[model samples]
Target: MSDADAPLSATPRTRLRRMSQKGRGDRGALFEVLRAGLVCHLGALVDGCPMVVPTVYGFDTTHLFLHGSVASRSLTTDAEVCVTVTVVDGLVLARSVFEHGVNYRSAMVYGTPRRVVDAEEKLYGLRLLTEHVAPGQWDYTRAPNGRELAATALLALPLAEASVKTRSGPPDDGVGPDAALGLWAGELPLVATWQQPLTDPALPATVAVPAHVAARAGTRADRS
Candidate 1:
């Protein structure tokens, strides 16, 4: 298969033991879930205990890039870690509370992330991160200087082992015995949109919003 059609490598740890049907082995599926999310929860063992930190991330075809303060314990650890990204699409309301569920797309990546030391790669990774969160802001804003780069820590985790899962549509109880209850059963779709840009009060009224930024207002922030 081509790289885009390649399957995700499944190790013992990356295997799904529960809800096996929802597990996706294709690399494209994993990329899709990650692309739709802006944040990821990094799970690692810190000082012999478990710690999960929420942070923004960026990725390319080969790896995921995470950046944070140089002092953060979560990024410093070179041990194996689990990174998760989840995007909730809607709520599945069923006739019975027990049958209620959520519509979501999620991915779990397993690897021992390494700290990026090369200056060129670090800067490139940072650019990818900035552009991922805000499409045009990277070019519009000033690039990080030498001192700013020194204070930041960047980690690169290979996208070799991962899994994706997604659930969507209406309630599952519609055709089951609960259907006799005759209660409401449907999906409440959830959508996230960007609102009007709030300008900095310090900026003079003469400064107008940039076209790239202004165009995003009132648009969907999340991809299905």
Candidate 2:
């Protein structure tokens, strides 16, 4: 099978013990979850203690990129880390409170991240991060200078060890004993959309909003 069509490896850390049916093994399914998320929680060991920090990230077919200050504890090279991204689609309200659950798509990525030191790759990684957060902002804004690049840390973690799990549709109790209860049960869908652009107050009145920024208004923030 092609790499994109290959099933995810069931490694010790990535195997789903519970609700295994919800686990997605296809790489395409994994990419779908990542594409729909804008932020990821990065977990790492800092000074013998665990730390999980939410940060913006960008990913390609082989690697996920994250950037921060050079001295940031969480960006240490060769450190084993776990990165997770989740997108909540809705709330499944069941007949009983115990059966109520969330409809979500989540992925966990495990790897030892390496610091990006090559000037060219570092710049490209930064571009990926910027464009992931704001599509047209990279070309619209000034490029990072030597001093700026020196102070910033860029990390590239391989996507080889990753797992995706998704849950959707109604609650499982619908066909069970709870179905006899005279109670309403359904899904409360949740959607996130972009509002109209808020121009910076510091900008001159003569300046107009960029077409790329203005176009995002009223658009759905989550692709899935």
Candidate 3:
């Protein structure tokens, strides 16, 4: 994708195009790819130097919201941000080592991100952030105190400039003459699943695993 701040096509022209198979154009495709991921690579510039960092993000239908410690440089500045999220589901095992590949879903967004500053909106943004991780956990846990609230920064990136790339199924060369070589040639799928939760040693058994946490097993975000 071009580094220009404008939205790329639904499937941007990139080195990975061969694996990008989404049929829809624009927003539909981008949203689908984004929804399939839990973490995103957020890119921005600080003092003319390019910086790309991994971060957790949440989204409403029209925008993506990112939050971090108030001390985080990425959220503090009014930089034009580019966020990309990718989720890999399998390793393509081919007879030839040169043809190895991974099946994945990805989305990239470009824009001048706006930081959310209002207290009410920030609280709502926090809910979007937390609930996006575990649908019902926001209300069950302790709400942020004054100190915690003052230490968090949130930025919401619009869906205006975004695109998606996705890949599925088996390797293209899996059925070539290499197939007769007797070498294994198929997809080795990777899946993410939640394990049991660990509770704080000081907490009593009366503080049960909230339904939100209990329901998270097998969730896509639980990807290992």
lDDT, model 3, position 172: 77
TM-score of each: 0.97, 0.97, 0.84
Candidate 2 has its poorest 10 consecutive residues by lDDT at 1-10
Clash count for each candidate, listed in order shown: 0, 0, 0
- Residue pairs of candidate 3 with colliding backbone atoms: none
Give the Cα lDDT of each candidate.
Answer: 0.90, 0.91, 0.75
Q: Which structure is stronger by lDDT: 1 or 2?
A: 2
Judge candidate 2 at residue 161 and give its lDDT.
94
Which candidate model has the greater lDDT, 1 or 3? 1
Q: Candidate 3: TM-score?
A: 0.84
Predicted model with the maximum lDDT: 2
* Tens-digit lDDT string for candidate 1 (1-224): 86568998878887889988888888989888878899999999999999999999999999999999999999955699999999999999999999899999999998999899889999889998988878899899898999999999999999988888889888888889999987889999999999999999999999999988999898777755
